[model samples]
Target chain A: MPQVTLTVNGKSHTVEVEGRTLLVELLREKLGLTGTHVGCDTSQCGACTVHLNGTSVKSCTTLALQADGGVVTTIEGLAAADGTLHPMQEAFREHHALQCGFCTPGMVMSAVDLVNSNPQGLSESDIRHGLEGNLCRCTGYHNIVKAVAAAWPVMHGKETVAAE
Target chain B: MYDFAYEKPTALAAAVASLAGDMDAKALAGGQTFIPVLKQRLNKPTTVVDLAALGLVGITVTADSVTIGAMTTHGEVALSAAVQKAIPALANLASMIGDWQVRHRGTIGGSLANNDPSACYPSAVLALGATIVTDRRSIAADDYFQGMFTTALEQGEIITKVIFPIPQKAAYQKFRNPASRYAMVGVFVAKTAAGVRVAVTGAAQGGVFRHAAFEAALSANFSPDAIAGIATSADDLNSDIHASAEYRAHLIGVMAKRAVAGT
Candidate 1:
């Protein structure tokens, strides 16, 4: 067993893991941060996406030891400590981006990264293409796309939301 | 997945030693493709050598070539300004790989070493006349790719970096499989310093291959109309539920035409 130390959100924890243990398993099983869902187990579903050193990576496919000494931010860490929802989460709630809600956590996590990385702003097609890894089995992408567009302005700290 | 001893060596020599010591030891890079295969129990290695600690990640642009370290992720390459300026087509090819999450972790060397039949990198490498540098020796793109999921890599061999010469005119056009987003037919057209080369992936049964006929046509004329008369035979093309060999053969022409036209 290898002892791996990683910072989740703002907390640091060292955990022992087998070589085969995945990063998702460590986050869910050991740290009790089950907010990150493992929808597809395979890399297809973005449900396991989390910020690794500020970039989104599929945790289900990442080995536990691979994340050693890395910074991770899951859905649980996305909100402010004051209990205010992150802009993207608030956008999802405001625009009803999710239903059946199975994919919300990953969706929100992925969405935040997507918006933040593109400081220049994103178009509707860019959002659609950006979120291609995230599948809403409910097929409710119209509202999701709308919600992402709404969130973009807010995420980039612009006062007025995009008119789209 | 089998329980294997994991080693993350800080130095390249130590990493190579860890892999060379055990024949079953596999080098883990990015883990986009390797982990999925491992989860399916398709591969079992005695020890997994992680290449992350070796710091094999970076990109450099010289006068006429771009050098990318083995561990440089697709996301990094796609987002790199230097790579975009040096070879916009390469950046375009990288951006279209897998997706955002996969791109953040999938490395150029990992894709080359795995050499999946439908991968987009091999086509760019083949067409651009890139050089694949390994721990031991450098292999030309022409000789690096062997076939589907096969390459010229020897046991315990590890790729360090890949150097791509900037082409005067180059573009890649891919017809994607909707479900998997893997290239159903990808054609990279490049007018390099040497000559014109056209590399096609996904459709070929023998994996990524250069189309000599299309290359000759484009070299003489450098236009889509030049290859309009050339016909790609369905023979030796991959046939599956996703695409019939005939359909893929047709796509080869369409994609190559688009690639040449810079669409």
Candidate 2:
């Protein structure tokens, strides 16, 4: 077994896990951060997407041992310290970007990462292409694209999350 | 998950040494493929040597070629100025690989080493005549890919970098699977200083293979209309739920024509 210490959601967590333990399992089981869902064990689905050291990665395809000493931010940690919803989360809710909410956590995480990287704003095609890894059986991607654009001004501090 | 020893070696020699003592030891690169296989319990090694700490991430462009380290992530390659300037077709191919998360973690060396039949990297590697450098020896792209999920790598060997000769003109066209986004019918066409090389992925019976017929036609005329009359036999192409061998065969021509047009 390997011992891994990672900073998740602004908290440092140390756990002893098997070498084969996936990072998603470590986040959900060990740290009790169950916001990151595992839909497909294969890497095809981005349901377990999270930010690793400021970049997005699929937790299911990453071993916990590989995340040792790295910084991981899951969906649970995207909120404010006092439990305020992030702009992306609020945009999803306002835009009705979800159906069953199965892929919300990952969708929001990827969207945030996308808007964070593309400060100049992304087109609908860019958003769709950026979130291609993330699958949503519901919504047909119409609302997801809206939600990303809705979150842009809020993310860039150009418009208020509440105003949007 | 199985219990095993984990060692993150910062040096290539040290990483190889960790694998030397244990026959069941595995080298971990991008973890895009291995972690999923491990989660499915397809592979349970006693030791996993993580190469992320070995400092093998970079893209170096020279006057004649570009060498990408084994650990360079797909995202890094896609966004690399050197790669874009040296070979935009290669950069475009890298950009189309998987989605955002997979691209952030998947490495060129890992994909080439894994030798996935539907992967996009092998097409570029073979089309551009890249050289695969391993810890033990260097193998040319022609000799690297052997079969499905197989390569020239021996047991415990690790890929260090891949050196690709800058082609005179090249382009890759892929008909991706809707759900998985893997290439259903991908064709890479390159006109190098030596000659024109055409490599097709995702439709091969074994793995990525060179299309001699397409190459012969392109050699005669390096134009899109030149490859329009060429026929690709369906006998050796793949057949499954995504596409039939006949459909894949049909796509080979369409994709080859687009590739020739540099689309």
Give the best candidate by TM-score: 1
The segments of candidate 2 whose C-alpha lies over 4 angstroms from its true place after superposition are A162-164
Candidate 2: deviation at residue A59, Å?
A: 1.1
lDDT of 2 by residue, B124-236 (tens): 99999999998999999999889898999988788999999999989999999998888998999999877889999999878999989889888888998888887889997
- Give fnat (model 1): 0.78
The global C-alpha lDDT for each of the candidates, from Candidate 1 onward, is 0.91, 0.90
Query: In model 1, which regions exceed 4 Å deviation?
Result: A160-164
Candidate 2 chain B has its poorest 10 consecutive residues by lDDT at B1-10
Judging by lDDT against the true structure, name the best candidate: 1
Tens digits of per-residue lDDT for model 1 on B129-205?
A: 99999999999999989988989999888999999999997999999989778999999999976779999999998
Clashing pairs in 2: none
Span of 10 residues, lowest total lDDT, candidate 1 chain B: B254-263
Rate residue A150 of model 1 by lDDT: 83
Model 1 CAPRI quality: high
Q: Global CA lDDT of candidate 1, please?
A: 0.91
Alpha-carbon deviation at B15 in model 2, angstroms:
1.6
- List interface RMSDs for the candidates, in order: 0.7, 1.3
